[model samples]
Target: MPGRVQGKVAVITGGASGIGRATGFLFGEHGAIVVIADIDKEAAIETAKEINSLGALAIGVGLDVTKESDIKDVFESAAKEFGTISILVNSAGLNPRLPSLAGKTSEEIWDKVIDVNLKGTYLACKNVVDIMAKGGGGSIINLSSIMGMVGYNSVMSNGLSPYNPSKAGVLLLTKNLAVALAPKNIRVNCLNPGFVETPFTETLTSDAELYDNLVKLHPIGRFARPEEIAYCALFLASDESSFVTGAPLLVDGGYTAQ
Candidate 1:
């Protein structure tokens, strides 16, 4: 169990915080050489250092997933250092409530969310395919959301937020890549997590009224911990899930089931 991903190299975008950071720690604990890539350079480095202090091998790199060059550099550098890029966790994403979107036009908000959530995942997968094929196979774990499988409650959303659509796009992208890369032995899958207590959901979770309402949506009556989702990503990353591909594994606390 300790070395489930032994000797594999995993590059996780948005590894500075939230689900990404949790996944990084979990993968490292399982013996993967972790590459923490985040738009926040300082935070990424700090996370890497923390992981290293925990006796795991990790390197932090600044990455803006929206930039093709950044993705190229991270993949190339990781490959050069570790010799093979085996796991990719596309955790870099943006939601409508991101603080940076304050005062931005609706169009701008949509564009940014889509670019980071949907397009960023695409770029990472696109750049890593060849590398993985050369290494004889790998796993790609995309972070979709419950919204991808179901519409937002009309009371909470006007049905125009790009967040839902972007996640939905990830589902299809994962499937397409799974089929296309099947021959290469590369496995592609996604995780549709329900509301987890992460910075990404800060706006809603921090609101007492809103938080209670959201929790009620999940039959479990509570949100997930970051490690819960990380464990699912670990299963997909490890050979234990070799036969699973193009699957959207929902860690939604029965949110979608309802």
Candidate 2:
């Protein structure tokens, strides 16, 4: 039998590593023509090659979601290569831990995080809406965080953290887009994951004490694996979620329940 998303096309940003990479692999396994779009061109290519090696149709495209030109080019290329886009996973993001944010003014950090995490999502969705609508509708999975729903603990951050608000923006964006596009049959939703063990969290997880503290926050007693999050994305992307839209599906191991 064919896979759940057989013959569909999926474009994933930040597809070079972590949750995005894992999602790319899963999407490919499910028979989607996967497009790995990332700023890390080489890694994206390698990921696409790996997917192809697994006997799946896949391609890699360089994308900087913060740039409109790059976003447009990625969709255009995917459309030209694989036809209409059926799924979009906006997984590209940045956190305050990025070395570039060190010593930067609060305004600078806020702008940077919001640009990549929030605005980038908006841009990708804006660019793909037409393609998906024209193709008879599709699914859009945005990556939000538990922080988007609740305030960060003091252990995570003392005052307002830019990452928190940026993710919150993503959740709202997902909702707004979902509502607007529901009439067109396009489903827009977001995944609010707890702390996940990804390259993006290496800085914090690398610190043994911090890692332990982080784990304690999640009632599940551990941080999530990338594949764990990928599975959630898979459900949202597949037809199994045909009735789900504008929802902030929490895969946070009960972190927000407390």
Candidate 3:
């Protein structure tokens, strides 16, 4: 009757709102000592409070995915307070309007998107892996999107690209880390979600036609709830996936089936 992640210490990047917040809450629900790390300090504290309300240990840290100092401080504190980092959710990423292969998007847009989505993920994984390795073994889950697995659309009318390739990069990063960390018993994986109704996509929710179209696109006939994606992440980060690594688990509600 033990919870799947009992006694585990998990640090989630971008754990203020959207999927990150939901995952933090659920991870605690399942017995993880949750650390909600985010750039938005106020929101992170609020999220930490919510987790504590659930009778689980929780803390919030001000962190920026682009900053090594922040990652170091958080990991050090987490290691000291919550014990070793047994779970990591690299959910910190951005969705900037980018350009296409040609002269489509602006240089600034592409840089920001790649910096936050790819570089950000790299930093978190790089910092956490050492902690996990020292802890013996752990699970690392990176967030990718359906756009990464396939070209969903043109990121820009002029040629800007946004999420497609960045997510694709995440997909591969997950696999690479899995292989590299396998010798140490650490598991690395990715979660690819399609059109989930979370704060990250709340702006799009107002467009009825767009929302309806998104629903129709999924074979399941609905966008996923944040908790649904959290469930998939939970499985990957827990012993439930003891034999799973270097795998990209699709929580797209069958959007890729088409």
Candidate 4:
């Protein structure tokens, strides 16, 4: 049997690690030519190499998602290299540096969090939708969080800053873009993940007790591995989800079921 995404071209931001890296590997294994884009140039290259080891085509790109020109260039290069892009996965974002709401939150930090988390998604969609549209249609997967679903007790010493709001913004962005691009045959969707054990989340949940407590918050009493989230992204990025759009598919281990 052929792969689900055979011959497709996919651009994945934050592709150096965590969900992005995991998704890159899976996409490549299933036959999509992958473009690994990240701010960390070396890691991006390494990830591309790792994906290439799976016997699929790939390239690593250093990019600042906040820069429109950089984003445009990524899509342009992918189009030139692969003919046209059919998939885009926006997975680049970060939490504010750990600080109490009083000690860590600042105008600069707020802007950084929102700029990368929200604005990055906005730009990726703006830039890649056209590429997909030109190809008749395509799929877009926005990385949101369970944080966007409701207020949670954020342990960031400086507090939530713009991370929470930016995620919430992505939820709406997914919806609006889904509606706007539906006529063009493009599909837009989001994944709202609960706490997953990744290098990025380790800073917050490395504590055994705290991590366990976090787990208990979920009906499943465990955290999702990065691959779990990546699988959700894969489904969204594939034709299997051709009818799905404007939906924030929650993979929270029942964190929001309460």
Maximum-TM-score candidate: 1
Top lDDT prediction, candidate number: 1
User: Candidate 4's residue-wise lDDT over 1-258, tens digit each?
Assistant: 677888899999999988898999989988999999999989999999988887888899999899999999989989988888999999988776434223644787788889999999999999997788888889999999998887776543445457788999999999999999999999999999998877777765778777777888899988889999989988998899989999999999999989
Residue 48's lDDT within candidate 1 is: 100
Q: Which ten residues in a row have the lowest lDDT in candidate 3?
A: 96-105
User: Where in model 1 is the C-alpha error above 4 Å?
Assistant: none
Error of 1 at 169 (Å): 0.2
Q: Rank the candidates by lDDT, best first.
A: 1, 2, 4, 3
lDDT of 1 by residue, 48-99 (tens): 9999999999999999999999999999999998998999999998898889
Better of 2 and 4 by lDDT: 2
lDDT for 155 in candidate 4 is: 47
TM-score of each: 0.99, 0.98, 0.93, 0.94
lDDT of 3 by residue, 1-258 (tens): 768899999999999988899999999998999999998988999999989998988998889888888999999899988679999998987775212233534676677778878888988999888888999989999998887888764322344475677899999998999999999889999999988887677656777877777788899999899899899999998998999999988888888987
- Evaluation by lDDT, superior candidate among 1 and 3: 1
Clashes of each: 0, 0, 13, 5
Q: Could you give the C-alpha RMSD of every candidate to the true structure, in order shown?
A: 0.8, 1.0, 3.2, 2.3
Model 4 RMSD in angstroms: 2.3
List runs of model 3 lying over 4 Å from the truth. 97-105, 154-159
